[model samples]
Target: MCFRIVIFVLFSISASMAQEPQEYLDFILPLIKEAGKELLTADNYQVEHKKEVYDLVTIYDRRIEDILINKIKKKYPNHKFIGEEESEINGISNLTDTPTWIIDPIDGTSNFVRQIPFAAISVGLVINKEQTMGVVYNPFLNECFTAIKGEGAYLNGNKIKTNGQTDINKTCFTYELSLARNEKYGDMYMYRLKHLTRVIPGIRSYGSATISLCYVAAGRIDAYQCDGLYPWDAAAGVLIVREAGGYVCDSNGGEFNLMDPNYLATSTKKLSDEIMAIERIADEERIRDAKAKTEG
Candidate 1:
């Protein structure tokens, strides 16, 4: 009787776990679409700077964040929320193991401010410290990227996958340097960019992390790398990439941590390794230079 009870309990737990991501995805999809509609129709937005001069925030960022947070909190009162705008307002810095919603209401605020039509709304759901679901919507382009853990990724209701390109020399890569918050890191980023540009055939920067990751998932780009990113910036996109059969990790080829400020993602593990090799060399040189300056 005890053994039978244990089997039933295990089955129940498995069933619940399997349904969690789907449930969250169902709830978030419509919300994301609605928010994207709001962004597409928005006008006369007031923009402001965050900690850095280049770090921008707009009124729509706050409005959309508030709308999402309020709706989510109403639905799941116990679930936690980590929003970019709210984090700045409330000083929330850490992510816990509880179910949490990590959101970047306007992922490409700079582009939005410039009317560049390249921005997106990024939403990531984490449960027990693992990314379970992600949704990214580009209203201007009419593209919606969605993923549920253990399931495949989708773009506008169609399955997506990485380009599966292995050759670094022939691949198109994106290196985003705008997210670097400090001057020292900016210099290091430029140094790495110079080396990568020499080896890789086509290099581009779209200035939007969310869209960059989606593009990688959709096989539009071979790889994307950047440092000094927040969890809200990567939480959604990383899951979508992983579900789309891509590889993601820290720049050092370590396991991906959403809280970490650095990220390297590629369509294939081979391509990731090749890019990391170059990044590793640049990182070593940067470390040596920093140590030399300190000792000098």
Candidate 2:
């Protein structure tokens, strides 16, 4: 009898430990979904900013943050949360490996403010500074993209794997237009845009980086390119894209670091290589032009 009781207790402990990560997701997803619903109904949300023009936050953003923090604190008292608003308010700090939660209460706040449904709630969990699990909920579209490291990625609870379309013309692409508004390269941005537009059959510019990456993970799009994004904006989506068996790298074709402010991601390894090759050619052209003018 004593041996049986000990075995049962051990089994119970193992079960509980295994459930922790899923428990985190289960706890957070509903809150995010609820927040999304609230956003749809909110008519009085106003822009609240940390910096007058460069950074943007909204009342709905704060409300969602409050909801997330309250739930996270209540459920996991020892866990640390790094939210966009809190980070902006308290000043940014280094991300530690202590079971940190990275959140963008509402990614694509400009879209949200303008009554566009391209916004989403992005939640990611990191253990020892490596992203382990992420969930991006777009309530307006009723799409939920989730990934657990090594377990694969899913959309709406259905398994989603990157599709195989190695050809460029058959591929679909999405680009982030946010940075182009203040594009540092001037018309070089237009050059890349023109180049990509000519190649891909479909080219889209969606305001949500997280959602855009999710689309890639789900095979809705084949690639994504974006610049000037913070960690919170890309962290969850990066994990999703990677877990979906896609390739994610910096614009220079380097390994992806979550903290890096630039990224280029694609649904297939071959597609990424091709896209990077095109980007390099365009960059070379610009360099050659600059050198020619200097010598002249």
Work out the TM-score per prediction.
0.92, 0.89
Best candidate according to TM-score: 1
* Tens-digit lDDT track of model 2 for 1-296: 99999999999999886677788888888888888887788787577657556467878888888889888899889998878888877865677878888889888888888888898999998878888889999888888899888788999999997786578889888877754445565556666776676787888878899999998888889999887677788878999999998888887898877876588888888998988888877777878888999999
Global lDDT of model 2: 0.83
Q: Candidate 1, residues 81-115: lDDT per residue as tens digits?
A: 99999999886557778899999999888889888
Each candidate's clash count: 0, 0
Residue-level error in angstroms, candidate 2, position 56: 2.8
Model 2 quality (TM-score): 0.89
Regions of model 2 farther than 4 Å from truth? 1-18, 52-54, 179-181, 185-188
**C-alpha RMSD between model 2 and the true structure:** 3.0
- For model 1, the stretches where C-alpha displacement exceeds 4 angstroms are 1-13, 179-182, 285-296
Worst 10 residues of 2 by lDDT: 178-187
